[model samples]
Target: MAQLEQFTTPVDAVVSRMRALDAALPARDGVAVFNRVYLTVTEEVDRRVGTGGFPDPRTAITLDVLFAERYLTAVEADGPDRRPPACWRPLLQFRRHPGVRPLQFALAGINAHIGHDLALAVVDACRSLGCAPAELEDAYDRVGDLLVSLEERIREELMPGPDLLQIADPLTHLLGSWSLERARDAAWSAARALWALRGLPELTAEFTDRLDAAVGFAGRMLLTPLPD
Candidate 1:
């Protein structure tokens, strides 16, 4: 129906932009690496939306687009006057470091997005849809589940071989210290808290700033360069 197509237009536009970025950047570039992972996830979400996988397709599409736009905005904020959010600064700054492995790049981006962007995206969706955070929970959980399912695949594809990944490997410890499951949990909590504070603009802004800084610190630690 025309209504369904109207709802999906934004999702398609975001997907097209991501695909363009995937083509534009080199495969090993840090932003490109995460962009590929995110593009695939977005495509999957789009497919599911068309197939009735989401009970509330409109909400799912809106959240997916809103969530992705945050990252795309960061990507475009390259000018001196357009700084990215604190949570995204680490990945953009260290994106070209020779000692930072591909897995680190991927996870660092994930941390910035899920830990920081997802919560804000939830609030964005609420405002757009004129609903509460609880109303968006099902769509949020579904999207989170898709990301969680892809995390293992990402690790398998990007992690170094066993010879380089010894039990004492710093990479092993670093990766183990940051779990996608936990990040997703925290984002959900933050989304609820943000929704509760929506009426208090000053407190909401302060809380959001702290969350951004904290997540950025974690991202910085995640991107620590290891010896090649």
Candidate 2:
């Protein structure tokens, strides 16, 4: 957590923490696979924020920080048996599975983070700032666009060579089933729904739970172990 605490900007803190994880985890470890991809995206976002690319820098930074904290909190969980949100559980549980490919790890992590955590993080940012989801939509869209652009590059870099990525390959099918663009769309919808239901805490909680579970299920599918 020292790396997280040392940075003043939310993006900086996240970048530092991911770098630390990338250094600490085995190069081929599932978590490391995703961390390396994510670290690059975050660095790009940070650079964009610095350049005034985001329409609302303050809101963007706030939303980004809150979003990243959810993932980091899960990473730092102290109890070995403690399960995180459904979106996160698969990665945490199957990260070391010998049969899972690096591409699976990368996509699963992206799915969990964008499908579930991003929506919740939007709500968190709104609540913390005494604003509404609409106020933060600009920031959300900016971030989502960045993620969408980087996804192809991530897949290209992480996917096995063409010889191993045949049309009949299960990995090919699995990877094709999940798309960053779709996840981002779902997250935005979920965020809007959560904001609308904010007045009803119980309903909101239930909605959030359902969202987490659904994302987790998707992640589990993404992480399905494949034989070498």
Candidate 3:
């Protein structure tokens, strides 16, 4: 496993850590389930970076790496028994529950990362680059586009078979209410809002807390355990 500081490229380091997690965790574990989905997205972003898909490669890498570090840091900081953030608690706490399907796990993780972590990551990137949110808009949109595209495929791959999934199932309604595209759009908006309000630490902190709580509420809903 590569330590966070070992790699010069932030994306490379994130990809390495995610891959290591995939290898170490059981396939059905909630974190592992999300890691697999996220790993694919990171790899694609890395490919795009190699192929010159972004206008600013350096800025793109910086945003992508810093964006990922937020999640990695949370995981690293929370030892096996420690509590994660409100946004992460549902997935982490109910990871091994038999009633929680893979789709739930995947979506819950996505909710936490995209809705909560991504916004903060944007602010983190802005501070690190000493640039405004508008400056990083291209990189943000490109990364978001990748996530939106993959969201469908992840649902299709992880959802229970049609025969097994009934329309009346609560999971159906819960999943329907959450959209990755919507979340991505909202995250971008929140990032811009945060950037705009950075000068007012109290306001920024309040907005961030509200976002975290909202995302956590969604995660808790997504993790609603179903009957066998």
* Candidate 2, lDDT over the whole model: 0.84
**Clash list (residue pairs), candidate 2:** none
Q: Compared with the true structure, what per-residue lDDT tens digits does model 1 show for residues 106-184? A: 9999999999999999999999999999999899999999999999999888888877855228988888999999999
Please name the candidate that would achieve the greatest lDDT relative to the true structure: 1
List where candidate 2 sits over 4 angstroms from the true fold. 1-8, 166-168
In terms of TM-score, the best-performing candidate is 1
Q: Residue 136: error of model 3 in Å? A: 1.2
> What tens digits encode model 2's per-residue C-alpha lDDT throughout 110-143?
9999999899999999998899888998888888
Superior by lDDT: candidate 1 or candidate 2? 1
Error of 2 at 143 (Å): 0.8
Report the error of model 2 at residue 220, Å: 0.6
Which residue segments of model 1 deviate by more than 4 Å? 166-168
Worst 10 residues of 3 by lDDT: 1-10
Candidate 2 lDDT trough over 10 residues, lowest sum: 1-10
- Model 1: lDDT equals 0.92
Model 3, 1-228: lDDT tens digits are 143223336677799999999999999898899889888888888788778787777778787888778777766666676766788878878889998989898889889999999888888888988998889888988988888888889877877776776633667777999998899889989998999998999999899989988999999999988887
Cα shift from native, residue 103, model 2 (Å): 0.6
